[model samples]
Target: MRATVAGTAVTLTAGALLTAAMTTATASPPATATTPPGTTASQPVLVDCLWQRTVRPIDFVLACGDGNSRLTGLHWEQWSPDKATAVGVNMVNDCKPYCAAGKFHSYRVTVRLEGTEPWKKHPGVQRYTRMSITYADARPDGFKQVMTYPLWG
Candidate 1:
């Protein structure tokens, strides 16, 4: 009986000490840095474009400009609400060799939305909405360039 009580007391004492040590170690320091007066976080610019009948279901070819020359044959993906997982290929014919330290290239994509009878009543009638493109070198876990484009009248 005495041995069992001593063991229980030792275990309880160890647990109490561990709890106290964790509480002290996990305590956070008070805030120190403050933004200057009248400063605020900048907001991202939203890109919205009007949808035209002819613009529906279109293809875009993008060029990679190295501040002077245009590089062709670069590939990219277009994401939209109409087709959630559509992959469009680039049809660039003349492309220079891939350069590591050149200016980043800009791409254009063509999107197509099938016309629906009920779509006419919709304000934007967005057959598709471009979401984002994941660069080839992007981390597989959770890295991608994501943006939303809203269609407006």
Candidate 2:
């Protein structure tokens, strides 16, 4: 899939790059706080990002209002009725310029979504029970010891 990643036009192809040297994220709930209110029974609800950079030199940040980390692009490589696997890029904040103005650097990541549970806030709505993020590429600076970030925060 060809999409914009940090303003860089990066193609996420399913192959060795996705299967090799991958970091599987731990199981966790979805970002409930970020999930919009009065959500219906929507299949694959897309999370809205605060910002997305151009893909020329690869510079974009997708702030889903989670406030933990931003991402570039997420493309589902394999998805089924039971589970889904996706490949994307995350830009961890580097407290540069200032904490609020921190810049986000790119890192390849693999995300998995599985398990379904009813949405407590809204009845008749189901959301992913667990979402995981594994470092698919080299770890960014300041994240040497960390491999995955909580799917929900």
Candidate 3:
């Protein structure tokens, strides 16, 4: 009878320990995830720059900003790999308004680098480019302007 009572006590102690462990495991708080501040969920404008290795011909397309607004001008500068100076520049100023917002008097500048130079080198990269755009308007309050959207890709 004494042995039976001792065995029952041991069994009850083991069961209590197992129940405590399971309760503690389920009661613990879950991990929380967070995102960086000042980051937005808006979609970015799309632009592409194409370069030919043998021909050294650089071609680009400006497909940024809202389509409702017109682009008045586009400027591009090709920089050497070192980024010390510009090798080529092209500017176009023939854009008409597509919407009722009137002609979007704006200038956009884009820079693209192809191949390697004495100062810099890029390998296995199809296109390396940067772009900037600015808007203008003749308003009595002043020239209403908006800068280019920042993109890091």
Candidate 4:
């Protein structure tokens, strides 16, 4: 009977100690750094799958840049608040006869997006400053192109 009581007391004391430790650990939230006055805080920009359409004419249409490429999928392999590595598939048309009755092809591409800019025409909004694309596999004949912002609008 004495041994049983002692064992019970030890268990209760250990339980009480654990509860007290947990209480003290979470009693207050961690401190955060304050932002300085007149300085803009860096904001994270999430990459959107349909960002292609939003930029239009300036952003290449995946289809051989003949305006026949349709983005089938965009998978983000790695991403942070402001930068990303992504893979995408562009369903392209060979554009025989100006894209009429053209053969459709699938092109695999890897993309990198970086740099941040305050969106023109909109203060306080952020956008990617640069985007680059590389063909993961062989590209269609003479389809190599470089991207420039505000592309041929």
lDDT of each: 0.35, 0.50, 0.34, 0.55
Clashes of each: 7, 13, 0, 2
For this target, which candidate reaches the highest lDDT against the unseen true structure? 4
lDDT of 3 by residue, 42-139 (tens): 21112232222211223333433434332322232423333211222233322444244344433333333333322112233222333333333222
Q: Between candidates 2 and 3, name the one with more favorable lDDT.
A: 2
Query: lDDT score of model 3?
Result: 0.34
For each candidate in turn, give its C-alpha RMSD to the true structure in angstroms.
17.8, 18.0, 18.6, 13.3
Off by over 4 Å in 4: 1-67, 145-153
**Candidate 2 steric clashes:** 13
Per-residue lDDT over 47-146 for candidate 2, one digit per residue giving the tens place of the 0 to 100 score:
2232111111122233455454665577777544355677778777776776588776778887666675544444454445555667866866655433
Steric clash pairs (candidate 4): 58-151, 63-69
Clashing residue pairs for model 1: 57-111, 57-112, 58-110, 58-111, 59-110, 60-110, 81-129
Q: Better model by TM-score, 1 or 2?
A: 2
As a TM-score, model 2 comes out at 0.49
Best by TM-score: 4
Rank all candidate structures by their TM-score, best first, as comma-separated numbers. Answer: 4, 2, 3, 1
Q: Is candidate 1 or candidate 2 better by lDDT?
A: 2
Window of ten residues with lowest summed lDDT in model 3 = 41-50
- After TM-score superposition, the amount by which residue 10's alpha carbon in candidate 2 deviates from its true location, in angstroms, is 48
